[model samples]
Target chain A: MSEPISGKSLHGHLDTMVLAVLDKSEAHGFEVWKRLEAQAKGGLKLKEGSLYPALYRLETAGLLTARKEEDDSSRRGPRRRIYKITRKGKRRLDQGRQEWQHFVSVVECVIGAPA
Target chain B: MQDLRVHVEKAVRPVVADQGTKLRMREELYSHLLEVFEEERATGDDEAAAILRANDRLGDPAALTAELQATASRVSWYEGAIDRIVHRQDETEIGHACRLASRYLLAIVPLIIVVVPTVWIIQTLIGSTQKSFLDLVSDSLWFGVPFGVFATAQVFFFTIIAHRMLRQFDKPSWRPRSIGGVFGLCAVSTVFLLVSSFALFSILTGNPRATYELMMPKWLIASSLMPFVMTGFVLARRREIERLEPWSSLEIADET
Candidate 1:
């Protein structure tokens, strides 16, 4: 597990992270969460419950579309709903990525990278 | 699994009153937790241990509910409160009635506060002609018109509010749609009829002088029926609400 990011730090970045996860392919809540955790090396400290709201908010904002998908794998369970990035979502993602890059540059300039 | 479901329901109920969102949330959470449990069990964890582990990972209920509510489209306080009261699963008919009455009563509080004094001041300026203060209030058609208009307007406003609140924030399947206007009309009518009958009987049997004064002239009585007509209007509006697209299957594909 990677070191968990503080809740304060995670606040604004969650939507960006969620959209980036969906940038690869459509995935349900669990798949998106697993990929996020893996990417963060378990340092993300993202709560399962909190993750859902981010997905929902993004979906509500028209940045993503969600549809019910039947669970077809051997591990039988209730149907899972997958979220796919909409055209709007992609545009927002690009905006979000640019904003993040500018933010990182400013912070790095201020604090200076590890000597 | 049962524990997970109970946790999810408790966490989600207050925040997501809409049936479609609630059901989808519950299913999604349950499926996620079950997967966690299964993965734990595969790693030589016992069933109880897996369940315990999965439950812990679900997070704080209050925080989660708040997070979800914050992110979703905002529902106003009255809308959410009225929605919960009307659509609650265990509420009985009596309970529902009381909740609705209290809610409507609260909505009318400002009008009552304003109207009573305004009427009193108007009467004071005009100078009291009747024997008692109560008689002054009871005998005047001028006071009655304002009271009736304001009160009827309040009823109309609240009826639309109730309909809009339910239609926008709650799913039809959670509470019976028929509860809105028809049931309210029947209840109001029953009370109105009983009181009017009692008053009519009292006037006929008890006092001839009182009969002439309190029975009201035919024209006034006809005008007084405006509230009932407004009630019919509210009922028709509720029927219109019934035809609104169910929030269950529909998705907002775009902001436009």
Candidate 2:
């Protein structure tokens, strides 16, 4: 079995990943975690608690906005702070994607491609 | 639900953030924990086992708290003002330092306003018996400069203690402990300053009579009252700011 990518190793990319997740649709904290988990397909190992600080950082930077609303879907739960990415956040994600591609190409060139 | 709430509280307890941020964090964390717990239960685990598994997946509370604090939304009005003033994108490093220094000086304005005039009046009355104008001026500078410096230092010390005490007010669990800590600090600082002033006076004049008659009573009163006075002022200013700008509005982004 392949070793799962630890969340610690993905710290720099977490912001972009979060932006990417939110770009699909606005989601509350739990839903974001669920989607990320589903998308990573067991290749990513993330602690649930670590997601909040990233959310807060993004919100503070005006890259995303959040508001609390009642979750009708949940039978027993508090109001969820639904987060959505801002236009600036979309621009940042585009930039991040381009940079990531360039970085991958450089590394692949140096490493002579994956086996 | 209650179990998840308790878990969230323990996890977020160590985060030193404003009350609003803490509440939002607690609610969000609790919501997430509940979801995790329910998912675990669906896998046939009992309530206790599901809760345990959910918490384990949430990771260590201390580590989470540290991360949360790192990105903690700053809600203090002074912090907001300072960031606005000092953190301009175009501002150079030296300009940033200078602006911060100026803000520190501005913070001590009340201290200077209260202390300088009081020191002058006391010096004038004490030196009334002096034969020459030069003697009075000399006496004022001799006593006033050191007193002013000591008073400034005391104000800063009390302000720091008061800031910490005020921060504690955000955590309901910490309120009683904070009050006791404040009183303890006040008593300790009073005693410490009294002894230090006596030593300072003796070293300056080498005359116990002069120190006792000239400085001790008034200086002692001022030094002893300073902690209470500063704490009261900080509390009052905080209340006024809260009145003007509600804590809810201090969040970085308005609700959408």
Candidate 3:
């Protein structure tokens, strides 16, 4: 099996990716993890510890808000917390996406790849 | 839940400041670990195996804790100063007391470097008897005692004010009143430190009269008042801190 993307490579984009995942749909911590893995096609394995801190930092920065709700689907466990992207989060995501695209375009151009 | 909590507690290790923050972080991390354990169990791992695997995947707890500390807003300056004094995160009460004593002594080094020369320049320019407002109050043996007593009271009040103030970041309903009480204590402590140091320097330089005139009152007041005043303040505030911190955990009172 291929090694997961190292945290060093993902560190810069973690906040943006978290915002993107939440932007698609509100998710609890685990749900967000699952979607991130799927989005990365199983290559973007995240350290479980780092992910929640990022979510918390984003929440503290006013880019996200969280609410706890009963997990009706599960019989016996704790309530699930759902985190949603705020308007500020959407704006940040747009900026991050633009930056990422620009960076990729510049790198690809240097490598003589098709646009 | 118990296992997950124990794992997290072991990882975070001696969490100081903001009980509410620590508890909330633990619960959120616990829920995430439980989800990971469930996924591992789905793959036919036993309960123990699932837990082990999940814990491994979470990365180092120490690293996670450092990151969390970095992300959290700074503790109030009063709390920061008090932490230096008391070494609040240390394991034993004796350790805390010793750390407090050592830190106060260390404060003298800074006084010698910064305060002494400034005082010398001011005194040379103004005259021998020239006194700042702090000097006049500190000069009286009678006033010095009450001033020390008042400063001691102010420290107690300011600590509460600082802790509750930081608690406001988490609690929108709680608003802090004037922080000048704490700043006032800081100012008093600074003057007290410098005057004491300057007098000590004078006595060592064969100027014992200056010691009698300036340092005696401070020593008499501070040495006599500080211990009782600090003890009383701690004892007095110990019971009432709970009502003050809405967001703090129930266990914080015991810890304090």
Candidate 4:
């Protein structure tokens, strides 16, 4: 697991991380939660309120598409809405990554934030 | 992905409260989860552990969705209340519409039956002093093919409306086609009878008033006295009626 990134690390870089996660395919709310958790090695705690709102905002931004499916109650579970990344989403993810990397370099060169 | 479908199918199959909505919700979640799995795979973790780790990080799927129970409860309560209000409104509106439509059809059919045929009959009775039945029929055919089409239209309409109205009463939902069919049918019937003779045409048209007047003018009297008729139709197909009135509170059992 990578060292925990600060909440500061998360502020400008969430789109990058989310795109990085969804890059492989579509993901629902839970997948986004899990991937984000794993990105920070379970350290970036995103409340559902924040995570979902962000996902929704991204969706409205033409980066993600959310769809609901019938989740039969498990022999003992419930139902949920799944989200997917579109082509525009992939492009944005790539752009976000490049931007994050540039921002990281600029910060490292000027502010000298620890890696 | 397929595994999630199986999970979703289980959630939907045996029937939970609000099962239809839950099932729809499950499919949406499954698509999202499948994407997560793909992302997990793409990160190039140890393939063997990736799904496990992803699942582990995801916490409990059921618990994740428990958030929906509150939403579901609220939505269901809203749905229930709305169902009643909606159904009541629908019944009032549809009932009013049905009554108005029936009244219009009744009056129009009689007017049609009497007027169209009487034009022909009066022509024949007046015997060439004025415009004749053949003149009107033939003149229309000048542009309209003069098949005595209009008189036929009257009869065809009358017969079909009588039949279709009976059917509409028998079934809760009805299409405009069911009623419009009377127009062409009565047209044909009128043409056929008018071809026979003046007396036969009058006989076929029957009573103009019968076609026009309401059998039961008072919905208050009729509706109050015969609410059971509406109840019977609604109860017989409870599921469908419920769907139509999503806000209805009636527990009319679906005919599974």
Candidate 5:
């Protein structure tokens, strides 16, 4: 066998997971962090520093754009900068999808010995 | 429509900058969420809660804005260019006035170079031996007459440009009262540059008392240094003066 089987190990794969979630719909900083936290399934965690930096990099690469907007939940309307995916971001998400599929298939190819 | 706009704003307005994009996103998302809200309404839902739920379903505002911004970059770069194009009447007027003033000065200044020297040589050669006030008057008037006339024309033209510039700003009436100040500045500087340039030429060509030379070269001191220094002043101040006033005509609170 050339691989090991693990149910959930998404922490190291935060970028892919974060992007996959975004591929479904646009989200804010807190929403994205919360969604990724939930999807961890007990095996993934994202630090604010890590998640924010990844967001910033994706933004700088023409894959994302950002602007300030009022969050309305504000007792006082502090600015919240929101990000959105571009066409390039969607293509990147598609490529991420393909990679994840390949990775899952590679693992599935080698992990069997009667259950 | 009001509820739809608010709901759409909550979902999409945070990300988009354009009125068209905001309206479009509002309509599209509202149509989709309207169905979901109606389902709750049919189940005896409260109006406010159903509307709130519809907005919630649209998802994170920050995420939406960011997505739109990202998409903006991918959209044709011309979209941003449209926002930058000047549409104000004041901008167009100022632009036109600047072009006219520039062309007028360019043509007149060269004319000054032509007419000034021809008159100077003729008057200098034909002068009386007398040094009386009338003779001095004639010497300079015959020579300085054309030069003085041209300078006067230049001052009037300078006043016109400065007055137009003053109009562009949305200040108190006191702003235009300073038009005379600009004219005074240009006039004084013209004198200083001319005197210094002529002093240099007088020293170089040996004190204006040397052998009488009828014809001077094209690159003589008055023509070269006078225009050069004066032009440096104009070119240096052109951009700053043009932008000295703010684009908006919004009035400010009076402190006086």
Candidate 6:
């Protein structure tokens, strides 16, 4: 089995990952984690603790907005804070995508494309 | 589920943020952990084992708290200054006491200015009668100069006493008690000064009844009102100190 992706390797890209997840649909903290994990296909071993600070950082930067909603589901818990990506977040995600593409191209130049 | 809540509380408890931010974090984190716990349970794990797995997934609480504090919203400069004054985390006890005493002395400066002139004028009017307007004006200036000097010296003496009393209480926790002690000392000193002044004036003029009739009622009124004034000042300052408490807690958490 391939090595699982560590949170340290994904540090700089967490914001982009969060914004991308929320951009598809606004979700609470747990759902956001679920979506990201689902998208990574079990390869990303995201530390649940790290996700929150990233969310808070993004919210502080005005890249997303969160509002508390009373959860009516059978599995009762505290009010869930629903996070929605802002227009700024989408713009940042686009910028991040371009940067990633450029980085990939630079790496491919050094080590040629796979056969 | 209760275990999950407890774990979340422990995780967020050390985060050095305002109440609103901390509360939000607690609720969100608890919600996230609860979901994780339920998922683990769904996989046929026992309740205790599920809690363990959920906690493990969340990672270390200390590392999480550090990150949360780093990413928390910034406090305004005014709030930060109040926190610094309230905690004085970097200052030695002696330094903090000196600063507090200096602030007390500085606040009393305007009160001294107003009181000294008023007292001089009142004394001059009461002392002189059956005299020309020119004589009255001259006597007022003569009384004002000496009274101003005396009042300044008296205030400086009291301030020094207050400073020394403050230095005795090395622990910050004793500050409120020390303030009350200082105010009580000032009240007692004011009454003592009034009695002494009365006795001195009687001796200098060579008439006890005349001195009492001329100065006793006025001085009594001024002395009686001083404690109330001091009480009001203390109450206002107490309110400001209370307002600093929440921010003070953040500073305390940061130190830990």
Worst lDDT run of 10 residues, candidate 1 chain B, spans: B247-256
| lDDT (Cα, tens digit) per residue for candidate 2, span A4-88 | 9997789799888999999999999999998898998888888889999899999999999998776577456667899999999
**Order of candidates by TM-score, top first?**
1, 3, 6, 2, 4, 5
TM-score for each prediction? Answer: 0.56, 0.53, 0.55, 0.33, 0.30, 0.54
Question: Candidate 6 lDDT, tens digit per residue, A1-115?
Answer: 8988998899799989999999898998989998998998998987797899999889989999998786577766667889999999899989988999999999998889675
Give the C-alpha miss distance for residue A78 in model 2, angstroms: 1.6
Q: How would you encode candidate 3's per-residue C-alpha lDDT over B195-223 as one tens digit per residue?
A: 65555446454586776676767765654
Ten residues in sequence with the least summed lDDT for candidate 4 chain A = A45-54
TM (chain A) per model: 0.89, 0.91, 0.86, 0.78, 0.74, 0.91
For all the predictions, what are the DockQ values? 0.46, 0.55, 0.48, 0.09, 0.02, 0.57
Which pairs of residues clash in candidate 5, taking residues 3 or more apart in a chain or in different chains? A27-B63, A28-B63, A65-B70, A82-B66, A83-B66, A83-B67, A84-B66, A84-B67, A85-B67, B15-B65
For lDDT, candidate 1 versus 4, the one ahead is: 1
Which residue pairs collide, candidate 6?
none
Any idea how many clashes model 6 has? 0
Q: Between 3 and 5, whose DockQ is larger?
A: 3
Candidate number with the higher lDDT (1 or 6):
6
Positional deviation of residue B205's Cα in model 4 after best superposition, in angstroms: 33
User: Model 2: what is its DockQ?
Assistant: 0.55
Off by over 4 Å in 1: A71-77, A113-115, B75-79, B86-89, B93-256
Write candidate 4's Cα lDDT for B116-172 as tens digits.
Answer: 567777767868446666666555345332223343443444434444334443334
Per-residue alpha-carbon lDDT of candidate 1 for residues B142-255, written as tens digits (9 for 90 to 100): 444444444454454445444433443234443445555545654454445444544544544566456546654643565456445645555555533453323222332221
lDDT of 3 at B83: 52
Give one digit per residue, the lDDT tens place, for model 2 in B1-256: 5556656666665566544566678778877888899899999999999999999888777778788878875443344345445544446445555555555655566555576567667766897553455555577668766665565555555555555555545532333346776777677667767776787677668796889888888888877795776467656666444532322233322111
Model 1 RMSD in angstroms = 12.1
lDDT of 6 by residue, B183-214 (tens): 67667767766876676676556798999999
| Clash count for each candidate, listed in order shown | 4, 0, 0, 42, 10, 0
Error of 3 at B35 (Å): 1.6
The 10-residue segment of model 6 chain B with minimum total lDDT is: B246-255
Instruction: Identify the superior model by TM-score, candidate 1 or candidate 2.
Output: 1
Model 2, stretches more than 4 Å misplaced? Answer: A71-74, A113-115, B74-256
